[model samples]
Target: MSLPITKSRFCISYSISKFSRFFPNPSSLSSFYSQSPSVDVHDSQPPSDDVQDFVSQFHSMFHMRPVPPINQFQKILGSLAKMKHYSTTISLFKQMELKGIQSNLVILSIIINCLCELGQMRCSFSVLAKILRLGYHPDVIALNTLMRGLCRNSDVKKALTFHDKAVAQGFRFNEVTYGILINGLCKGGETEAAIKLLRIVEGGLCKCNVVMYSPIIDSLFKDNLAKEAYDLVTKMISNKIMPDACIYNIMIHALCKERRIKEAKNVLAVMVKTYVKPTCVTLNILMDWYSLVNEMKSAEHIFNTMTQLKVTPTIISYNIMISGLLKNKRVDEAMNIFQEMPKRNMVPDRVTYNILLDGLCKSGRISNVWDLIDEMHYRNQQPNVITYTCVIHAFCKNYHLDKAFELFKIMMKKGIQPSMHTWNIFIDGMCKGGRLQEAQKIFQYLLIKGYPLNVFCYSTMINGLCKEGLIDEALTLWSKMEDNGCLPDTVTFEIMIRALFEKDEIDKAETFLREMILRGLMT
Candidate 1:
């Protein structure tokens, strides 16, 4: 497919002299847009029935005796692009070009957007060049797409340069242009530059909106310039540009990160007072923060407030409360929340099950765990490695080594790859259950399989040996651990030093103690 060379009313005569610096040879890029390249088009078809049917209709229109209007084709392409079927959009555009359909700025802009989304920046720019070559002036949307493509690729500097050069060449950009640049600057860690740009835009270049202010404010907080971020919020409000829920969330999250809960609450109060209704995200952030800080009462208050405000709590809301209650050892309250979830039409996710399982295991409420696991199965929520490990840990703590081993075997049989922590738990369990020989066998197996055995792994085996009065064997393993490039940590040395002292090996104990001190593991 080729872009029609004929000039239409949509075409404009413009010079490519300024853009020449970015693309050294405008003519060289012509071949790129003249036809889609022979490279493999990695387009994944959208699964929507409606989209598929629309695509079918689009393909059928291509075979029509008198083809559909260009705007009709543009509409189809635009719809596909809007649905994020970027690859499909590009492919369909190529087909239209092959069919000799006349292209316009709107159609080319869609192609540019698709290329940008697909990270084909080079091709996206080539399309721009084709627009200029065809005597069609590229609109701000097209220019913004290119800038955004550059920013998405993390080449914000190039985007900034493009912006300056475009402005110098008498191209008037709008708020969308500045928004793209500001977001790029913020993401690239040029918060200061972004703020300066915001100031410039605020001073009559374009009316600064929340889109431009949000990124700068967020960047300020991330850079630990909280006061500046808050000041920008004030500036935004004073300019009569009300902060959205997103901005409020950013402020509250930042304050929470700094452990300024009171300040965060004050911001939330301000949001409510302004009649800018808090979104689910706004309350979720506050709920999560309260949970994290163990302020269960405050968390409960937020939870209650959500219902009162008619903002339905999401599954995440329930999960956060359950997790917080679990952490604070209020397992019963967590269970109550878990039970209330289904009543609220909130189905518990794997995370909810895992949290409850872990809490029950830690609380030694093993009897309740089996029923929960059964419920998880009934809900089609298969227990993951974490779930099995929690139960195994509980069993090991209760000296039910056989039961722990049984669960471990079940996990492996179900194709669940145990994590290093899981392996450590089982090995420690065996060692504590006087199954040192079995523990040693597993450790050796892990070594032979080239598992990344950590210091804890080695220390666990060493402690088991020392407890079994096998000091010589423990020392030999310690030497092998070092040889394998696993350095002994403070706990490892502490185990050895204490073992040596208990065995009346004074000289060896003193030597390890001194080494520990020299290594800064001890004062």
Candidate 2:
């Protein structure tokens, strides 16, 4: 055998008398057993073949011991991440550091990955500082891991900071890294910043094209910058960055918002004419667009076309159709669609109830509204704040103040504290019932209880008092309300005029009307 093998066999048999000036003999790992407690490193342990196999497999993965193997460290970090057990993972990384294994890029990458997974971007960045301070150069994978993870978790500020660091460290910020950062900026509603990042990256170091332009277009649409969004679409196609369904859908939404239905449809037609098959999101956006423009026929046509295409309508699709039917007063058909949701294995969510309830209430179908309440209870779907408020508003409108108060009380007792809308409904009921004093009492109570008094609430009470011949009280409250930041409107001035007229004080009424005119009212 080789001299190394001869040395290994001799080393296993007896202690060496001196250092050998010979071949590098691999250490006899079997001698490790005698130096310490015996270890059943092999699968010869019959009781636990599985555990023995695991141990053997682990040792076989990497041969070095002092450098606690990279895979085990990485696997531990991964499991912790998957479990979302961040604190424990952090502690383990600290332990690895204490063992002086000199965390490799892989170990550093995994730790940063875990930090980003937890959305602990601040912590991830702190680890980056540690990596740099240790004078250990991080590779592209390590830098990208931190960059991509931080951006994905919405820690865009730190992600960008790390991006600058990567560039400073001579790591190329490739398309994947830049794209992720742009996506994060758009999602965070920093459209200007996203555009700036895109501009900074156009030095031919990177080949950014139309794919980069989509998010900027989408962001413009999201911020209601429709004109800007429209301009970008033309710019994109001219630049040869072909518009996909997403880009087209975003434009369609913006155009529909502006009531430019024809232009929006042309975009959709372009999408359909191309290989870009209309997706559910596209169809839903179109349906919403048509509904918003009150082009009911177009909306219905799209719905029928979607069904003919063999693409099953999602819950959102069904809800939009039901809302359209109800808006057109096709109550029975709307109810049928609502009832048929479960047969397709789709259960109604909060939006479904909200659409139905709003429709019924708007149509003054209070009896149907009550039926929905019962249905909600039967289906174990507890009425939310909006549901309770809508029903109460309906009751208040019909002068059924007693029923409204009962439901409002029950809603409060159920820990669904009355929202501002709920309070506004009750105030309206009090106003209609000529219970101005009671309304004022509740107003003061709501203010004292720290429930914010919206302008609507303040206006309602001011009008109620002015109409009740409580002009002096109304005037004082109006001044105090303004001092408390409640804005007075044209109706508020009109009510003040009426209150002055109630006292047959024509001089003050005309004087105040002139002041309102100076304030850009009564024009």
Top-TM-score candidate index = 1
Kindly report which residue stretches of model 2 are placed more than 4 angstroms away from their true locations once superposed.
1-117, 125-142, 152-157, 185-202, 220-241, 374-382, 450-455, 466-472, 482-487, 499-508, 511-514
- The candidate maximizing lDDT is 1
lDDT of 2 at 375: 80
Candidate 2 accuracy as TM-score: 0.71
In candidate 2, what are the lDDT values of residues 372-447, reduced to their tens digit? Answer: 8888888778889999988888888888788888888888898998888889889978887777777878888998
For all predictions, the C-alpha RMSD in Å is 7.0, 15.1
User: Which lDDT tens digits does candidate 1 get at residues 191-238?
Assistant: 877776776776677788999999999988998888888898888989
